[model samples]
Target: MKRPNFIVIMTDQQRWDHLGCYGNPVLRTPNIDAIAAAGQRLDRFYVANPICQPNRACLATGQLSTVNGCRQNGIPLSPGQVTYAEVLRAAGWRTALIGKAHFQNVTDVPAPSRQAAGKGDDLPASVALARREQRDGPDYLNEVRAAWAANPDRTVPLPYYGFEYLRLCIGHGDQVEGHYSRWLRDRCPEAVDLRGPDHALDDPAVRVAQCWQTALPEDCYPTAYVAEEAEAYLRSCRADEPFLLVLSFPDPHHPFTPPGRYWDLYDPAEVELPASFGDAVNRRNDLPDALRQAYRMGDEDPHSYWPFHLFEPELRRIIALNYGAITMVDDAVGRVMRTLSEVGLDDDTVVCFTSDHGDYMGDHGTVLKMGLHYQSVIRVPFLWRDTAQRRQPGVSRVQASAIDFAPTILQRAGLRVPVGMQGEDIFAAPPDRPVLIEDPGIGVFRDPDSRSALISLVHDDWRLSLLEGCMDWGELYDLGADPNETTNLWFDPEVAGRKTELLLRLAERQLALRDLSLCPTARA
Candidate 1:
């Protein structure tokens, strides 16, 4: 049998429940649903971290964010770290990443400085900035829009984080820049001016927060650009040589702007509120102090990147617009899949669909994602269609993590899973292991004294989260009972022993996940 090709389709900030196959009643994702029907759907797939860069890095390296060192959104996947793509590429497999290869920081701005308390080690600000810039490769800023704006001719250097050919979509929504931006400019220069809320088609009826109807035609959108590029790449592939093509869509994220006809595809008035939306019980009993305060007083900076509470009207419109974006992506997927079949590669290709992470999508009245361990944010849709007959085709209730992605792909391609990769081959068998999710430095907001980091453990039927700086305030949800995660059983006397056992399990899992990528051959 021929070594199977790989096609990974990933979406940004999409919840597991937002797809047609995943129990979403309203959203029309027939293309994605078809994939699920034809193959295996991972019902309980979770991300290693509930952030874009960190979880994506985890998928690339098959290592946790803690091990790979991409612990947050701004942090880039270090060039030195080995990616599964790099391994496959080295082993005579072609690798290409199209659309939103966010392996590096998308913005030119640096993260908050954390200096050690030592007067002698302090350096001048300019020198410090220069040194920081030199930390990553010279092409580190390839994804930054400002850098691209300054140099229009700039393109991602070959073999970026293991992908040989690249077509990057930097930033989100209609306001994206990078290769897609260049393509859009070439196709329709006027479409560029039509992006953003400032020039959005007036939709006074829509009351979604940070949502607008983009005037850019659906064909000119980033989703279309990704599908077109992917189809072209598929047509360019050699039948004999195996290849890994990753199609990452940057849509269905913040500042919702589905273009053209997709804008009016769903009516906000008809959209129903999430079951847990504005639940007074969870707000009062389950929320940590910071979140409780935010829920009560409302977010001061609603437009900021951090997760915030949203009103019912705003959430309804947001959900409708988000569905529009998702539907557009689904259409794009259908286009690419048709191209794959047309090119006669469908039978030989191992196709997988998932997301880097998920958005709150109005779960618990929240609009975005962050440190929260809510199912809406951490759990994502994962569908695998292995036409090679390597894996069984059925809905799997087995819990899988993003870390398993690389290993699964490698194993399916008949490649050796490299040393130091912490992920198991998901297709091999059901892994009866607790999924460990680590989010560092996600503290309680507005509370100056509280500096929290989140570490969660998801086992059979329970999800446990330990917030480091919020005193004894932790979250324990019985997922079997309450899938919406409305009730907190952390301090409950009845589940006290269970909580202790789960905590012990979390500690054991952490210990088990320790870095073993490299083993010492010689004793010092």
Candidate 2:
């Protein structure tokens, strides 16, 4: 029998609630909705980390961030770790990665972090002035300074892991086009001039437009581009050999800048705000000041700001825009799915859809993925479409994490999971298995002090969070009664026994998963 082909489509920072199938009425995600309708959608799915690179690294290695050596965004996955692609390659399946794979660190030529750290206030006036400039400032001087300060040793010619074909962005959202532009300009100085009126340095818009033209075709936005490349690879696959294609898209992440058409697809007035929108829950103790600020900003203007604060009306608009982006991705996915059907490969293909992490679109007054354990940031959309089996379409309330994806995919492909893999194949496990999630610090570039690490264990009714350090403030919500997690039960003395029981259970769950680093602290 021919091994089934695998097509894994991953989006950047998409929230589960952004999908029409997930109950967003304004979302125009017909293609994704169709997939959910045909396949089992895991409603209680989650990611190991709320950040990008660490989560992607977990998906790649089937291990949590700590074990994979990619604990944060800037950190790269250790070269020694075994990847899902390697497993597929061993099974004689052709493997390819297209679009944003944040498996590697940003390649800094002069080491920006180093320069910024060492230069102090007395550094060259150009560098100092560059640091003071706003991200969207008039001059590209700051950008130039950043380029000079970046670590020169980090550049890799190709994508990380064993992907045979790659069209990927090296860093985060805004820098995606810029990275490629610098590379092209450096390699072909004469082919593309970087000076004078035509140069990108003169105008930032020109830089973006030029990068769009030079790096890819007109229809090739990140999401669409990855799908197109994956389709081409699928078409090129020979029947004698199975293939594994990973299509990763950088969308719905930041800059929220989908094309104007996508933005215009949804009416802001029609978009409904979330139930927890604008309401500050447990702010006295459970919420931090930084988080409050983010929520305020996100609620005020999610589109314009970098670090968003959760606001109800503004969050509605943001969600609407996010829904539009999801629709765009869904359309791209539809094309890929259609290509598979056209090639008669649908029956033998296993297509999985998920994201690196989720966005906190006004959930708990936070905008982006940051903070302790929250449903918005931790819970992600997970769907597995197995064409070989005629399984009933339904929703699974089982707690699923991003770590489970790699092992599950490998198992479905008849490949062995690596010895150190911490996740189990959800399909093979009993439906009642408890779901565990870990939060290993936050803020990609900043120190870990800004955020606290947490470990959450979710069973049928209770959701418990174990704070790693001295956080006098904590949260415990009975998800069954309060699905929105608006109330904090941690301070309720009446539920002390329940909290104790859940904490023990949380520890046991962690230990069972071989995560011995967790320790329970007494409630303050």
RMSD to native, candidate 2: 9.0
lDDT of 1 by residue, 101-179 (tens): 8888888775555544346877777665433543455657788986765555676678888889999888888888888
lDDT (C-alpha, whole model) for all candidates: 0.83, 0.66
Provide the lDDT at 362 for model 2. Answer: 68
Q: Clash totals for all models, in order?
A: 2, 24
State the lDDT at 258 in candidate 2. Answer: 53
How close is each model in CA RMSD to the real structure? Answer: 2.9, 9.0
lDDT per residue for candidate 2 within 1-524, as digits (tens), equals 56888888888888887787788766778888877888889998878777787888888887887677677655566556788888888778888877676665444332234233453356765664443422222221222324422532233343247666655544333234323444433444442342222332223452311111122222534455567667888889876778888877777776554553665477767877667765666254446554444444434554433345544555556666676667778889899999988888887888788888887676755567666567777778888778667545888876777788889988887777777788879778666666677666533244433455666777766677765554565567898898888777988998888888887887776777774323456774
Best by TM-score: 1
* lDDT for model 1: 0.83
Cα-based TM-score, every candidate:
0.93, 0.79
